[model samples]
Target chain A: MADPAANGNTDSGGSRIGRVPAGYWLAGAFLLVVPSFASNFVMYQIFGWSFILGMISLSLMFLAGYGGMFSLAQMTVAGLAGYVVAICGTSAITDISQNWPWYINIPAALLIAAIFATIVGWLAVRTEGIYTIMITLAVASAFFYFTRQNYVLFNGFSGFNGIFPPQLFGVDWRNPIAFYYLALFWAVFWYLAVLYVSRSPMGLALQGIRDNPRRMAALGFDVTLHRVAAYTFAAFPAAIGGILLTWQSAQISPGTAGIGPVIDILVIAVIGGLRHPIGPFVGAFVYVILKSFSIDILVALGMAGERFQLLIGLGFLAIVFWSPDGLLGLWAKLRDLNRRDPLIGRLVRRL
Target chain B: MKTRTLLAVLAATFLTATAHAQTLKVGALATLEGTYTALGEDGMRGLRLALSQANNMAGGREIEIIVAGTDASPDSAVRAARKVVEQDGVELLIGPLSGSEGIALRDYSKTQPHVTFINGISGAQETTFVDPSENFFRFNMDGAQWSAGLGEYIYNVKGYETIATIAEDYSFTYTQVLGLALGYCAAGGEITERIWVPLGTKDFASIIAALPDDVDALYLGLGGGDAVNFLNQYQQAGGDAQLVGGTIMVDGTVLSSKGDAKNALIGVPSSGPQADTWDDPNWQAFVKAYQDEFPPDQRFPSPSLMATGYYNATTAAVSCLNEVGGDLSDGQAAFRSCLSNLVLDAPNGEIKLDGNRQAIGTNFISEVVELEDGTLATQLVKIVPNVNQTLGIDPETFAGFGVPGRDVPECKSSY
Candidate 1:
């Protein structure tokens, strides 16, 4: 056996790199060089959208998995950030948008998203179990209606378009290759951050509060504060994803954070397995792929393209029914089953 | 012998290259999901009808159309557009069936100068009015233009001096309301109230209660499900206000809905791109073709405005293609020139683009009438020709009212 310290549990920098599993290293390498081989559509529309969604869903995972809160307002928060960026930055709605610089608008978006999430957390964390879901959903619906109606700031139903990313480094950041890297960077950063925080003291306290609020409170932890702080922490990734999403489409509208997307973010988190940091990304990939290609798939099956929602609904039901903990849980179960059967285990290991 | 063999190979290569270059790819986009699915389907049907009329050939090039769907969101519409453009590599794109989607497509059209984009059914004024794209062409009237003649018709013909307005709180509705308000107010009519409701509001009890009892008529700007819902609820509440409608309020989509509510819509004055019962030979022929093209179960009794918009746009595209002879070379300069200058004798009326590539087209003033078949349809009242985006007002004065909103085009004695 190896010492825990040598395993990089207590090591820093170079040693930590050495301790990373080969699978993670391979994934990292593949993700880094994805733009080299991927088509512009794949890089920009498929993977770029997946990473942005994954990051937002990651926020949901952080809340539900670590804090025992199934908040549907994560997308709403992301949308708020997008709205902030569009309103603060230049957009086609010159009458509405303040037209601030990107550097200013981006940070402002993050700050505003964090503050909004904090408030949502404050209201939501007071409730337990299904009440929290209901509250977040209500918040999401309210924001949708507000944005769709308030033309002064949100520009009503036709929200801000022509809101492109800053041309930093003499490059249009929304260019497929550049956008791919930008999304990848944020997705990986948040994933690693979530992983790190999951093992940290605050994460532990939040988990403890989730599992047993009374006991954690007895143990001298401020339950509400930790929960709200978790929301603040999760908001950063979601806000970044929102900013990227707005840039990707070069637009932001109420539909971006409508009730459909709010539920979709929750569905992505749950379907990917909220049990691990990597689950949301996996789920986001599945969703993005399905969303992008389901029409073709349906058409191939000699079905109408409009039945995509039905297909997605069926897939969601099947995954929820078969794997209560999602794809990751199903994978673990298969691995365990393979371990019990030596022949299958050998085949799996060889593959 | 060697020289003859080389000449044969060169000839074969030339023939194959010519054949390969003779195929034109087109991308058709619509909202096949969410609230506007039916509209998108009709839009596609209209496009297909136009394509079939052209025998799917334009400018000597065989047309290949790829269809994509959106949920009426700008982002999804843009993504779908990108997929068709970047992946399918289409040289032409048509559609995007909602207001915001049109604005988004207009922006996207700027980046893709090579691909010719024709407007689908989206009627937002800003799509072409504000920072209009060079490559994007709209062959259908915007929402404001659709309201041409309705305001005057209401004030002069119906003689309703005081009116209250209720509309879906969106840009399209805002523009439509602005159009009617501008004309009605200028003609010495007064608007008592303008109530703006969110797009998908199910409950109309409160809205019904809020309607001023003194207004001569209630001008409803709601569309699709909202129109049906509001009419249903209003009838249920037993409210007896004389009803006027925005373009979409009295569309076949809502009028044909099976309910006692639509009965209240009878005699309701409205204006739009098409009147279902227009006596014009071209319109009747177009309706016959539309009805024949799709089975009764798959379509409305008459073609909806959405179908008309797409049909007009597709007709323009096909005609322009024939004019340019399928030659998209020189960055499609010739094709675009043909498009800009072409006056399409559309099924609805003559359509020609203005300086900004926006359509200056005809509008139909009509009122709801129950046909002998017990289906609701619009009967023609008047036809307003050459209605521009500015609704015949000076561009400077029109812009001075600012972009359409709740309180925009403030009702006054005259402009």
Candidate 2:
């Protein structure tokens, strides 16, 4: 039951109000120049997907790390936003899309996704541990089947294709550079927002509930309400990620919210490290790279290319075994070793 | 001066020929993992066989293949498609072996206007007929097109009055059910009930028990492992309804694995390109090539519909590439024009694209039978030729058919 407020420095001295970290500035500068060095495919397929998927996994990571809720329905929340975008936006398959303006569609998508997540969270928060996992999983499974069968609304199993990001302000947002920046902006915004919230009073209360719900309730905090509120807050990022995903692929289907993808978000979060806010993005980077190129590597190795999943599984297993806290935890351990050795510490500090 | 002019002309000709010989990258996308892996593998084999047969050259241009694997999901397929087009810079694309994936890839084709996308066994109707992409061409029949004469065959030939339909709940199965229901109801047959099991469902006990006892036949639209499970369970449940179905119900894997359940399809006519049934030279050559590539001990027992579909698609692509001298710089308009009016003697007969760039060709009414080697194979019972995407119905009426579901055709009376 770690106190959330103790995790980061507060603005007690007022030396730096909302100061941007040097590491963040460095990372931001690098990301801004990525399109110049990388190809359009790398921009869209790798970084773009990594950011979007990172955000989705971040939602799960937030719930698990801060609120002690392991939700399997984060992807479902994202998928709901995707479906709302498709239902509201124009597509090639069905005539159902009202062709609403982006301003209306974007907000409506987020609202619907948030509302859906809150309801699911309300139901899920009543349970604890594995029961919570099972309930979220059930909700995810139900949504998948519902979208698959309900043709009139969800367009049956095919769902909707040709769901492009609205071309606003005389620019196609789906263009590689624009899309990358859009995804990056949302991802970084949510990451900072999550960091800020985890230190906020409500975040402290939620963490208290996560650690000891009985004590929190006895102390006059509505534990369930806080947990549900955490879910509603988390849904914003997941929903935004979903909207981006729909834009990236220009489509939405049952497979978007399928069980495999639902599990994948958990895998991404765990592999990146659930403890830190940046862990999911790290995991997403590895995941997107592996998914895009592992097949080629397998084929080049003179093996069946389809066995890429085997490679991915092996990588995930090795990472989990190496550090349950994920890549970030592994990094922390190396950093500690560096600090213990003066020469190594100097080299790291110089870098 | 005359000799120098001759030398210059010859040099110019050689340079032009060399320039035209530039390598053309073709990307093959398929679900290499998950439930449809075998189908995807077969499609790859089929494409490879076609490419090898052409000496890996089309229209005097060297062809380099880049294979991309999807997990049979639309999201994976789109990502894979983006990789092939944007990263690999493949001029031509083939495959993505699922119904939803096909539609996704078709929509994706709109974004990649310069790249020509050919279908690789995905049979969703919307991939072509609903919102056809100028850049995407399907050289094989869609699910509905495959169901061309199954309803009429079952009603008039087999004398089935009322039928119950059990299909996977997806666009592909829906199109299949619509194809059969339209023909059967039109031929004075009634669809008593329609049961749509979700994709990946293994249990058919509840669905079987729900079937009407008076059903004269049961049309199955399940595929691969799901079909095997359902057939076995349907048999164990003591269900005696005469089982007929779409092409997937009688696939090679289903025929070989279903054991006694395969008897349900022994005399029933389904639709697809079965090698044993369609005895054309082109068809024979394809089967022979496939058998040569994959020996008896190899993974695939025989060329499945997926294999043949891709084989035919690649074959058409190569033929067109040859016709146009392998130059796709003009992009979609050039490829579309080359494909639209051209007809090739494909494995399934004459393969030609309609105005919508959908396949208009033969649909073989096939039945399961024990081959000389004791292996079960689908034998050609009848041939439905020149079957278009419309499935013998008027375009307007077919459009009005709506999405296929339970009680779609409005059964008049039970015989």
Best by DockQ: 2
lDDT digits (tens) for residues A1-351 of candidate 2:
222233776435544544444566556666787788677887777789999999999999899999999999999999999999999878765568888888999899999999999999999999999999999999999999899889788976668877888878888999999999999999999998998898899988988898899999999999889999999999999999999998898889888989999999999999987887888988898888778777878888998776788898998999999998888777767655755656554434333
Per-residue lDDT value at B125 in model 1: 89
Scanning candidate 2 chain B in windows of ten residues, the lowest lDDT window is B11-20
Model 2 Cα lDDT, one tens digit per residue, B50-166: 998999999888998888998777888988898878877888898878887888888788878888899988888878877688888888888877887888899999999988888
How far does residue A169 in candidate 2 sit from its true spot (Å)? 2.2
How far is B234's C-alpha from truth in model 1 (Å)? 0.6
Candidate 1 docking category? acceptable
- Candidate 1 lDDT over B76-106, as tens digits, reads 8899999888766788899878887888899
